[model samples]
Target: MWEATLPSSRHYQIFGYPRVQTPPPLNKRRVCLRFACPSDLQSRLTMRRRASLRTLLAACLAVHVGCYVVERGDTRVNNHVLREQNLVLEERAENSVHSLIKVTESTSTTIPAPQCVLPPGMAEEIQGYQEVVDRVIDYVTTGDFKGQVYSHLANLVDTFGPRMTGTGELEAAIDWMVEQSIAENLDNVHTEDVQVPHWVRNNESAWMTLPRLKQLHIMGLGSSVGTPPQGITADVLVVKSFDELKKQGLKAAGKIVVFNPTWESYGVTVQYRSQGASEAAKVGAVAALVVSITPFSIASPHTGQQYYSVENKIPVASVTLEDAAMMERMQARGQNITVKLIMGAKNYPDTISRNTVAEILGTHQPKETVLVSGHLDSWDVTQGAMDDGGGMMMSWAALVVMRKLNIRPRRTVRAVLWTGEEQGLHGGIEYFKRHQHDHEQFQLIMESDSGTFTPQGISFSGTPEATCIMEEVLKLFHRINATQLTNPMTGGPDIAVWEKLGVPTGERHLARGLYYSYLTNLLHILNELFFYVFLALHY
Candidate 1:
């Protein structure tokens, strides 16, 4: 946690720099400065017996290196020019705050101006299709699907329970979607083969063996290694973070690392579940157990995919928050915690799966494409009703509404029901590999991996031009209160690969809904999603 601090703006002037806070008091230590500085100031910079850090700062201030100000107090402000020159604030030695902040100059602009460089008349161009967008909303809300869309989703999830990747059930679900696409008479209704990993979680169990024995609720993470038939019985070393594990160091050796990270949003905390095993194994830990990645939890464990390094593979699973906290308390009280975990999880060779694709050929630019897709795969824990079932239905419904309403788009509107998303986006990756040769043809890519119930609009990532166009397109959804647009770090993992190649990507955002809940705030959501998808084709 090093801080590069500088004097406050009130006391010192940094020419063109932003305001910054004063650095904390530095220890009075004898040190010599041998850094690049003005020749006149360099002579005054020398080792003085018991010289304070203040003297050094005053010397650097005299030079006023450049007009470009770096707010040292704000570490978040990146000056790439300094980085490119290998300039850094290097601490002289251990236990010494004595350091130097090297700032240099480059002719190019250090910081880009904050401006939305939209193409001229882009908004007006998108507004031209307002009438068509209205028709899409009307058709999905009152025409064919209106009240029956939710029922269709309910039937799909209810009929095909958990559609785990590489499972026959998932393949069956894919077949059903293909049949439905054909039944709807969508052109190019076909399936592309995707080879996906097969990780099976057969009967697994875990229980406490020390500090009062009790059965522990657990779910093995995807692709986790299975314990031997006799199982792994070892003392548990509870840690709240990877930093704590590093502090404990060798204490984790031959132990089961239990992670009980405090809730800090799913994006921040889920890392413990995904990479805790490898991190634990790095310290010679035999296995890792992470608290379920959720803000609120019943006495149930959650499961997600975990990646293991080739050299540091270890068994990993999720324990309920209750159990993780219980272990945390036991360890804090100087009680030795021990647990026995036995999992029958196995990873087989990658097998063939299919990504269902259906398209409405364009009326004008037939070769150009606007793809909307969602994963058909789910974790084996329960029926993935809300995980992505709604997304799948909505993407499919986009094609359905366009077909039923006889709205042929200028660019091809393709709906892909991706498989093996839970196993780390195998379907989407395969799609990218197969279509990358014609990458320019794809104008926009979107996915709804986030729960689709309680719709709020979409999060997007794109060039300023693309973002401006998307914002205008979203205006068409304002009637349903779903026109909000946000720029996120990413849209979603499935469509994320294409975003790298400068293709605009959008991820539908929802305000609420649990992944396991079967009850969805339907009908209205269908209005948003169906309208969201169908209208995107107009781009």
Candidate 2:
């Protein structure tokens, strides 16, 4: 730790700037500035006296130019490298507590925003399918098919607890989907067999053995190696980031690395869970435990897959938000903590599964297919009603609704319920490999795996012409508030695979909310997905 004290008596003037008067403190006329370096690097510099405050800073910067971080009254400021620029200035308002402005060499330029100019002749192209668009909007909004979609989804999830790949329940769900399609009078209903990896989690447990004995809620990551029969009992090393772990170096060896990173987004935080084990193993750690990637939880530990290095494999698991926070706080207080973890997870040989497909053949162009799909597999913990059960139902109900309405498009409308999506994209990969010859015939592809929340709009990914067509098609659903068309498109994993074939892909957007245990709430999503896929087929 390096400490620099700025006495109130000293007034300062910045380089090539006007002199400023110091504001007097209400009580004491003294202010102290403190900076800390990494523990391993703290021994390189010693706090020493100087004739003036400027001289003291010069001495601190002389030891390690870019190592020191300045803090005032417990408020941290970013550390800067003074290699190129000799002067760094910080300004603070007199009455405001948190107002800070930092001037550096790289802050001289301003970044420009990207252009998003729309092309011409969009409204003219939209007039071609004006009548069909109006019909789709009217049918989706005023249809009395809500109860059918809800009841079907509830029955599926309540019957099949978890639809893991290659499991009997997943196969049963696939068969049920096929039967429902046949009952709905959907044409070309069939199933394509796909081999999927089978990994089972028999049992898992974790407990804190030091500082205070406590049981931690944990779930073994998918495909993670299990501990020995005796279990792994080692001291806990808490790190907020991989960079912090690198700084520890050999100090992390022979310990259980617990990653307690702050919540960013799911895409950002999930990397820690997926790669934390291999990174820890490289440093000779016994095992790795990561905080769940979810933003909020009540003693709930979310589980996902973890990949291991071929040379350094180690056990990995996810702990609840509460347990991770507790262990991190204990470590920050300099308390010695140890954890014992036991997992009985193992992987077996690949098992046979299938992807369920149903189609409504086109009257004009039978070979041109407009595809809509959602994964049929999910994590093994919950009922999977929200993860993809709802998405599957949404896609299935789309074709059923079209059949009931006696609406036939110029291109075939296809609905596929995929399997083995949770473990990876096995079902989708197998489908593409088996049907690569027909790839050029695919007109448009969309999937609904996000969730079944209140429908907002659609996200489209395609060329400028396709985008303008989709924009005009969505305008018909203005009554339902689903007309927002964004250029930067995002869709589910299954549809993302079709982008390689230059097919236009899309996903239904939902209002920000969680999965409630109700089937009725998902009816809106069913209507939106049905309408979007209908327009994709016709246009």
lDDT of each: 0.68, 0.67
Clashes of each: 0, 0
TM-scores for all candidates: the values are: 0.77, 0.75
Model 2 clashing residue pairs (backbone)? none
Q: Kindly state the number of residue pairs that clash in model 2.
A: 0
lDDT of 1: 0.68
lDDT of 2 by residue, 121-235 (tens): 6555555555665665556556566456667877887787688875888888888888888999999999999998888988889999998899999988888888998899999
Question: Model 1, range 1-539, lDDT digits (tens) per residue?
Answer: 11222222311111111111143213223333343322222211223322222332222221213222223432212222222121222222322312223322211112211244456876676777878888877776766668555776777777888888879899989998888889999999999999999999998999899988899999999999999988999999999777789989699999999999765345446678878999999999998899998756678788888888758788899999899999999998999989999999999988999999999999899899988888888888767766777778878888888888788788999999899888889999999999988889988788877676665566676775565566567777777767655553233678777866888778775544243323222222343445564364363
Off by over 4 Å in 1: 1-122, 310-312, 513-530, 533-539
Model 2 segments beyond 4 Å from truth? 1-142, 513-530, 536-539
Model 1 / residue 198 / CA error / Å: 1.1
